[model samples]
Target: MLNAVIIGCGGRGQIFAEYAKQYPNEMRVFAIAEKRDYLREKMKKEYDIDDKYIFSDYHDLFEKGKIGDVIFIATQDNQHIEPALMALSAGYKNLMVEKPIDRDLKKCILLSKKAKEYGAKLQICHSLRFAPFYRKMKELIDTGVIGEVKHINQTEGVGYFHQAHSYVRGDWANEDKSSPMILAKCCHDMDLLVYLTGSHTARVSSYGLGGFFSEKNAPEGSSARCIDCKISDKCPYNAVRIYEERPNTTGRGAVEKEGFSNLEDAMRKGRYGRCVFRCDNDVVDHQVSNIMFENGATANLTMTAFTKDCNRVTRVMGTYGEIVGSFNDFEIYVKPFLGNDKKYEVEKIESGHGGADTVVVADFLASARGEKEMCTPIDISIESHAMCEAAEISRRTGKSIEIADIMSDKEGALL
Candidate 1:
């Protein structure tokens, strides 16, 4: 059986590990490195790992020599590069790294190059590539059902509560610490656009701002913490209402999964209980990017935190027809200029990230075993990251940034 070691035992890492249980014969977790004692112990118990195989520091695991056939790096965005470089240097030949390999463009390029130099097989967790929804879309486009793509429009509706939880008060709230909203949240869209169009992005222009989740926008009577706010009952972002209430009104289970016994306890101990507006958050809540591809196709992408539902809505227009879809419904509608229209519904699966988590794990294991090539290898994944980096530059400078300019800078850095 293929063996794997997880470098971060957080929620995403755990999700990846669950696949091993689902396909016990294909692969299994042999070890884990987690900073949190509880989480590390949880993995150790679940995987039946020995104490010697559990590490609080990933560096320690790498130092002890190779422990598995593959390494899964699910650390935070900024924390990805060092472990990845170290893992490759330590003779690990297969790596599954979470996306945006690094927030900095230079670091991303360097890590990608280093993996190649080390002859490592690298897969970035652009998991959507393996999801059924996107896979069907790719099939339709590849068969020319939509004809030659002319323009595409896509939107990522970050539900209001989710925006507050992830972008306002969570680990990814700050651009300096993690990445810009475009990279942190919408790189998947950029990647999909590139993948579907099968063309390199030529130029990108974007506009965005951190509009609502800030101290200036805080309700007049709101307190620094939701637990102390006078309007906690009425405020939509009340941490207690979102976390403490059983089957919470917001319909999200992040706090429950966090194992917080009560709202008061969570407020006293966790960052999730902090007031969204009062937190040290700086990422934008809304952004729009316009892209021009080398093949003359154009695209527009909008990401916003004010939506009532969390879904990706996409409309792809081609020379002879168009395809429109929504992830929430797992459905697609296609209308041709000269033929009969069609509808498709993707069969739903339970794994997180739209059933991509498990499929990607399966693919990674297959790739490691020399059975098949990875769907989202580092070379293909890096293009999307470059598009995101250009979009962020355009957002800040108020000018369209050329992809060639970004690539040239990387070349100059290498020189």
Candidate 2:
């Protein structure tokens, strides 16, 4: 069986360990590295792993654990590159890292080069690529059923509820702590656009703003948490009404109990610091990007946190036909001809993104054993993340940035 080591024992890390349990024949989570003692102990009990294999530092695991065949790095956004580089240098044969490679494009390229030099099989974790629905959709497009793609428009509605849970109050509140929203939330879209066009982006222009959710934007004389905030009843961004559908229910809602009553309670007993409004939360809550592809194809991407849900809406106009689809549902419409009747199809995919995480892990194990090719390679993910970084730059500069220039300048190198 292929042995794996996990760095970071947070939610995603726990998910990986559980995924391993379901793939007993192909893999096993032999060890994990987490700095928090409570999490280390919790993971040990939850997974029934020996205490010796749980380490306080990932480097310690690399130094002491049996030679790991694969390493999965699921650390926070800013902490990904360090553990990834360490795992690679320590002779791991397979590596799977979460999206954006790193907020710093330069570091992504450097990691790619180093993985190549060491002959390690590297897979960047953009799990949606492995999802059955998106995979099938991509297959249909590739088969020419949708014809030559001429233009594409994709919408990623982050939803105010989800944004507050993930961006405003969640782990990714500060841009400095976890890359910008573009990289944090929309990297998947960037990858999808690249995968669909079958060509690299030529140029990009973007604009965005943190228009709605903030202390200044919040109603007057309001507290941070939903329960104690006086305006929780009317505030659009209140966590209780927005997320859990209960403005009065505190502590047992979607977020931890500590942050429910007020910002003071949040600071005293929460992961995010007391400076909820003052922390470095500079990431945009809404953004739009216009892109030109190498084959004369163009795409428009709109991402908004004020939407009502967390699904993507995509419309593609090709030379021969046009197609529209929704990520939340399996409904798709294709208009092949002007006078022809529209064709509707219902797509059914398995749960958990149609088992994307399991499929990707299986592929990683298979490819590492020289058994097959991987769908999402290190290079493609790097290129997509590079585009994301470029879009962030374009958003800041308010100018059309040439992807070619950005790529050539290695502006993708670490932040």
Candidate 3:
């Protein structure tokens, strides 16, 4: 059986461990490296890990010199590179990392080069690529059903409450601490645009608007913390509503999962309790990116927090036909310029990340054994990440940058 070592051991990390739990014949969680006592203990008991393989720190696990068939790095946005670099140096050949890879494009490139240097296979958790919705779209586009892709438009509605939970109050609240909103949230869209186009980016420009989720926008009667706010009952972003009533609304890191005894006390003292408007978030609420592919294809991406739904709506217009899709429903409508329209209802796989989480893990394990080709490798993901980094730069400088220049300038900061 292939053995796996997990770093970080958070929600995403635990997802990797679960794969082993389900398919013990194919793989097993041979090692775990995490600092959180509760999480480490949870994995230890669940996986029946030996004390020899339990580590409170990843560095300690790495010091043991590469003891597994593969390593999965699911650390925070900024902390992705160090563990990955360590894993490669420790002689692990198969590695899967969570997206957006790393917030620093330079580090992203460095990891790619290091993987090449080590002759290792590296995969990024651009899990959307593996999702049935996008996979079907890719197949249709490539099979000549949509003709030649000429233009594409994708919109990601971050969902009102979801945006407040993730971008305003949680780990990704501040750009300085996490990543630019575009890279953090819309990188998946950027990656898919490149994947579907079958060409690298030629140029990219973007624009963003923030400040709506700030103190100036706070209601007149709203308090600083949702738990004690006088108008908490009326406020949509009140912590009590999302925490006590809808604790399972978002992914991990909820007070309920964190073992908080008092919900009100947690809301009063924790990051999620802060007012969406009064918190220290600087990421944009809305942003738009314009991209031109090398094959004369163009794509427009819009991400906003004002939408009622928390999914992507897409339209891919090609030379002779077009495809329209809604990720929320896993539906795609293909219409030809001269023929009748056809619709496809993708079979939803019952797993996380729209059934992509398990598929990607399976792909990683199979590819690690040289049995299947990976769909989202480091070399391919770098282009999408470059588009994101360039879009952020274009937003800041108000300039449409040539992707060629950024790619050629290894030491430049365009990425």
Which residue pairs in candidate 1 collide? none
TM-score of every candidate? 0.95, 0.88, 0.95
Q: lDDT-based ranking, best first?
A: 3, 1, 2
Q: What is the Å distance of residue 138 in model 3 from its true position?
A: 0.8
Which residue pairs show backbone clashes in model 2?
Answer: 104-415, 105-412, 105-413, 106-412, 106-413, 106-414, 107-414, 251-257
Cα lDDT of model 3 by residue, 319-340, tens digit: 8899999987978999999989
- Whole-model lDDT values for every prediction: 0.86, 0.74, 0.88
Model 1 stretches with alpha carbons more than 4 Å out: 244-263
Cα RMSD to the true fold for all candidates: 2.2, 3.8, 2.0
lDDT of 2: 0.74
What lDDT score goes with residue 287 in model 2?
93
- The prediction achieving the highest lDDT against the true structure is 3
Clashes of 2: 8
lDDT winner between 1 and 2, please give it. 1
